[model samples]
Target: MAEEALFAGPAIRRLRKREGLTQAAIAARLEISPSYLNLIERNQRPISARVVMRLVEQFDFDPRTLREDEAIGGVEGLVRRFADERFADLGIDREEMQELLSAAPQAAAAFARLYDNAAPASLAADDPFAASRREIERWRNHFADLDVAAEELADEMRLSRGDMGLALVDRLRERHQLSVRILPQEVMPDSLRRLDLHARQVQLSEMLSAASRNFQLALLIAQLEQRDQIDAIAKGARFEDEAARGFFTRHLMGYFAGALIMPYGRFLRACEATGYDLPVLLRRFGVSFEQLAHRLTTLQRVGQRGLPFFMVRVDRAGQFSKTFVGASTARFVNSDVSCPLWHVHRAFERAGELQVQFVSLDVAGEREGGWLTMARTVEGRGEPGETQFVVAIGVEAVLAGELAQARGISLRSDDAQPIGPGCANCHRVRCSQRSLPPRGRKLHFDTIRRGVTPFELASS
Candidate 1:
């Protein structure tokens, strides 16, 4: 068995600083020598199990929160930020970066925030869609409040297979006095759904599949019945601008539609029984792949929690259409693009093929570990300009044992293939798969000495 990484030294030091406690005071509390605590804080020594227990016992700290706050993911973000072109002159090495992360995580995060604010007035001002994507990326693809609200509503509704669609249709007709109509393709050209507010009618394209029809109807029902709740949640988010708020409001409605289709309790039971097999869940629930994957990310009930999964949808050009993350430690940021080597990109090559891969991501010297991921390419027809995309779903490597597709895959953290978020933020040197040098790197021209790497990224 591999040893558990002790990566909470920085977190411990931060906790001490917040409490205004000295190294000596914390050392006495943990029953360790002051020098040992100092070493741990310096990233030269790992925090021992005894120290962790002493911390929990003395300070009433939740172990999970501590682990998450100190995870290598945070360090990875710092590595990405430091790799920006503006910081190239600093010449920060991996070891020094680790020391900085371990000793002063709060300060590290503060600097990252400052860099974010100081770098640009609006990161994607010209492109509203890109700006919204970046906004969701900032939240790390998870909205805890939205998840809770959807799950709670699902639990309350308890709609079974086929019942949800009928219920939603009935709710719209009875409560809202709206008529549901599936219009001919030509009549509904360039649109999948349209609401005639004056006529009190909901019109959908006849070309939509059964799953699509049900989802659209359910989305309308959600807007009518859950608008106030969704609005309250959106208002609480305090989005920087109206576009972000509107984008997130639409997202919340989609979450409501998904939860209505796959209620939390039953979905969790089916997921466990089927080992989260996408095909099995789709067959059983009569839902589309995208719907099933979206529902899976919402299995975060208090006691009956399922695997911590995240789902991403991308087009052929590496544009992110949707993303949701459930794992606290395993985060997927900036779904606009990920590592080109990711299986999701390959799945697009062989249309309708299912691809599985295990990938690791390391930034600076800290290894962020691997995840068990599955991707499938999907094609659909809509209006003349309809967009088709591929969807990828993943769970943390530790939960791979529970997945059937992961049966033969090695679960070792080190055995997995290495990947990065994207070229702009990635700092992995000499990666043959690397498309471009990270923002902060200098391109070195070696006319005499040519290495196997295509691009040379110089830190100096």
Candidate 2:
């Protein structure tokens, strides 16, 4: 088999510009002629193994950049956006979209933002929760500075899973002169937590579990102590409104809370030791399954990175409540709807049991490959009647061999279930599970034949 050529022109050019080094200077350092380097930079010539090594040794370049699909996300996002009926007549192809993203990512992003802003009044532009979700996705759900600070604070506080709640309470009372009070459900009917500044009391609902109480305590600490750091990060995001900024800051505080409970270094080590077992980790961390799954998505510390994981939470009605893409290149992350065939939807039927499925997105060709998804139904935080949610986590199938969850499961494409982002964006015309035809494709209704799907899509 021929070795696949590495066409990393964009990455190389970006690195050169970022380092403020001329092509000729970098060429000289790599022991290559300027003309040859120019050819490599133009993607006419493949970069050699020796040059890759030289780049790593000289500039500490990440080898992953060599295979990075910088435009895949933008192209996929635009593909979905253009799938709308409004842009159906424009007839834009994937190649053109890819070129636009590759040439001017900022412009493409701005255009996407503009389109979002012009959306219907029902999809309010000032929706802070939506803005917070975007902000989380923008940072790939990892806040390095917050993680480091939380870890340091955890070290200083000497928190243990067994007595984490008590420890957090003591820290709050001693450090901030704030008392922790757990009130009955009736007393705080509408509120789970409330901070009375004058009384210096961090009141919590009695309905909250022990784990949730600890998390709330940690979140309060993050808000109070890490206010400056959180505010600085939110300011950098440049949100459109103050509400968005406030929500983003709250999310950062939550990130801090998770980090404090499960320190990155310790969590990563435990995950590796246990082959990324969620049940064991949940028990060890003294956190709910949802909390543990969320924490798994934030283990992206450089040099000590875990597998790039994506997490999503959805109700039985197919409403997505939370989504974090982490560093995965899965296109499904950008879509609002999930494929019905994915394990997440099935998790509702088999509540509490972990449902694992190997799925591949049926995009333009089978280019994105497969993913290993694990889902389980979790009890949502509520009072009288708790809302159940399916919390699902996924990683690229190629990287799932190391996970204990993938044991006895074949990661081969032949065995994997073919899925898509959603019925509207999916190109799987023959899919029986499709609820709606693809957005921009014309439907062919044949009286003579009935296929798996109600209508056959015209092949463009």
Candidate closest to the true structure, highest TM-score: 2
lDDT of 1 by residue, 5-115 (tens): 455666777789878999999899889999988888776786654565577557734333344423334665666567777779989866877666656665666676677
Residue 34's lDDT within candidate 2 is: 90
Cα lDDT of candidate 1 equals: 0.70
RMSD of 1: 5.9
TM of each candidate vs. truth? 0.77, 0.78
Q: What total of clashing residue pairs does each candidate reach?
A: 4, 0
Model 1 residue 424 lDDT score: 68
lDDT, candidate 2, equals 0.79
List per-candidate RMSD values in Å. Answer: 5.9, 5.5
Candidate 2 per-residue lDDT over residues 1-460, each given as its tens digit: 1222456677788888988999899988889999988888888898865676577557745544554442233365677667678888888888988887666555676677677557553565567788777788778788999999999999999988888988899999999999989998889988889999899999999988888888999999998899999888999986778888888887898999999999999898999899999889988999988888889887766667777788888888676788887766465756677888888888888878899998876654443456789999887767434548899998767667768899888877667787877787676657788888876567888899888988687654
**Candidate 2 wrong stretches, greater than 4 Å:** 1-127, 197-199, 364-367, 383-387
Instruction: Evaluate all candidate structures by whole-model CA lDDT and list the values in order.
Output: 0.70, 0.79
